[model samples]
Target: MNLSLDYAIEMDQKDPLKSYRDLFHIPKDKFGNDLIYFCGNSLGLQPKTTKSYIEQELKDWAELGVEGHIEAKNPWLPYHEFLTESMAKVVGAKPIEVVTMNTLTANLHFMMVSFYQPNKKRYKIVIESDAFPSDKYAVESQLRHHGYDDKEGLILWKPRKGEELLRYEDLEQIMQDQGNEIALIMIGGVNYYTGQYFDLKRITELGHKHGCKVGFDCAHGGGNVPLNLHNSGADFAIWCSYKYLNSGPGSLSGCFVHERYAYDKNLNRFTGWWSHNKETRFNMRHDFDVLPGAEGWQLSNPPILSLAAIRASLDIFNEAGMDALRDKSIKLTGYFEYLMNGLGDDVVRIITPSNPKERGCQLSIQVKNANKELHDKLTDSGVITDWREPDVIRCAPVPLYNTFQDVYLMVERLKGLL
Candidate 1:
């Protein structure tokens, strides 16, 4: 079957979500044409409105000084609060259960410190074999910090032999074998390399049934997928806003502590002044009064500029609800797969889950006989995609801004490269 590039472009022209493509500042090549940007899974293209939101914060900082905390157009003291309701809506979480806080890894450690209560009997943590590097490092460091050998405390739930994806049954089998000795199950909500979105509700239920705490490193899942973290009953979760959230590089990340854990004072946590009771915080009392919800996890004042970028992004998210965004995402990414598969297995293979419900926006393609050279060729040809080590290129067509034509054009470039 001939893959007609013009047909894909025509599909883009008729796409209902096509107008969103203009919302982002798509990158230009040396020739100044918009490059095919399929790297939203890495760093999303910045929103065109980001400048104005940042400008507002910068102007307020210039004019108000410390007074900006109280008197600025958007008061810095409660700026994060402004984001709560909308961000909660985007992630299928309750407002009190979520907070925009520290970086992803930092928040992961903080949450683990509170949730991963490894005792003498149950001192193990189970994680996916292909978990992100930072998450593995954080979990390993936590084990060492608690005086447990990583080999003893860390249990990896791996894929089957000669397989690229992990099955839920594999996780169930591990739980049956070691659940009695496991204290926590920390898995990436979406596998970073394979783009597999786990069945969070099922995983959470399995973990709880086995008397284990469940948490998620949602860096790849957060905005890219509709994660009902609250309803899924995940004890805790962390996600960065820079990727699908489109909040700029190194932007503030988010943390979620289920509403069930909100007022559980018996629950352990590493607290700070920001987590102190806001009502009497200004009074400067000696009592370690903690906030009622996830805000109780805050350690320091968040950078307003970073939060400003988040606000800009969340505003866009609020306008384009997660359900609508996800609907578009399935169709767009399916188109990407359809186009890539058209090239046939002799050239490329998609490792990401075939079922759209089982994955998000990313399609991890393993180019046969292709090293970094083929990836570089695609980059040089103006198709921007990410190469994960060994041999996989990840391309995410974000529903918020990526059009069907972007996916179509990207495949055409790869066909040319081959």
Candidate 2:
């Protein structure tokens, strides 16, 4: 735990997941040196196997043409099915409860359609004040579409004055005061800005107790944290595969609908041929025999190439295991925090929770009087990190591909800049 380069090197040498770094194609500087990548929270580095995964599909298309749907190596006809169990495992859901389709916000809207059933009396929706912009936009749009004033129908679970993290007590108070008027509670499992991971089960229990449906946007939590979606008992959850999941940028997303709603065919949803019973999907004149569970949420066939990349990443996740990844994440992020604290609070202060259980790998650092110039300098110095507006710099040391040394060198470079 000492703040020394030697200590970081020793930790890397002993890291159980160290070999995973080589499995990913880390970006390089102009000199071809590996750039210290800490932006995995925004976009994950590509897996080495992703090339072959896509290549296999390309080859199949070249040989089989239109017949690739049935003749492809992965069989494009049911390509999304191939990723079911693995994707389900990644989010800790049953296969029947999970599916990979559409993009993140799109899937969020779909889930809202089914879960955010609001009446005039209970029409407001609850979200964290710092919810991701896309989620905010989607929820606002949903409120408007439902003939409710967005400003009036949207309830914000805000942090106390000058606080960076949201408190459960505040949420409990919100439920106590206005739970009757709240129809849905959609929270980000891991807040994108502050790197705070909320308790899904607790939130779900609280919402259900208030006679409101609950869901989560797990974009930041999905692969980075141990999200037991099934056990969390949330009505639904959605996540993109691009970040900690290590799929390509803007790749497909995964959806989780709790088992309780699996057989509820009467639940209103937007559907297409893909949601029909697979056996009867080709029957041109058949009635809509909706497929059971999460598959029923599908509106169209998935893009196989994207799913190929997802499959490659999920294969690695399955091999490394979430439990092992989470263990390394705690140690790795703890070390990052240790180094940041060693840098002295005069220069930089981490806004993320001190407790490892309350956050993921990302540490949002509030650099005193720092601006975009500092971030640009870090980039030019061969460190890749992301900058939020005002004063915060977000750095994520991904457990699958990042190392303790990466964290150390990054901090060292940051200290030098200071």
Number of the predicted model whose lDDT against the real structure is largest? 2
- Per-model TM against the reference: 0.98, 0.99
lDDT of each residue in 224-340, candidate 2, tens digit only: 998899999999999999999989999999999999988999999999999999998988799998999999999998998999999999999999999999999999999999989
Clashing residue pairs for model 1 = none
**Candidate 2 pairs with clashing backbones:** none
Off by over 4 Å in 2: none
**Positional deviation of residue 278's Cα in model 2 after best superposition, in angstroms:** 0.5
Query: For each candidate, how many residue pairs have backbone atoms clashing (under 3 Å)?
Result: 0, 0
302-379 per-residue lDDT for model 1 (tens digits): 899999999888988888888888998998888889888989988899999999999999999999987999999999
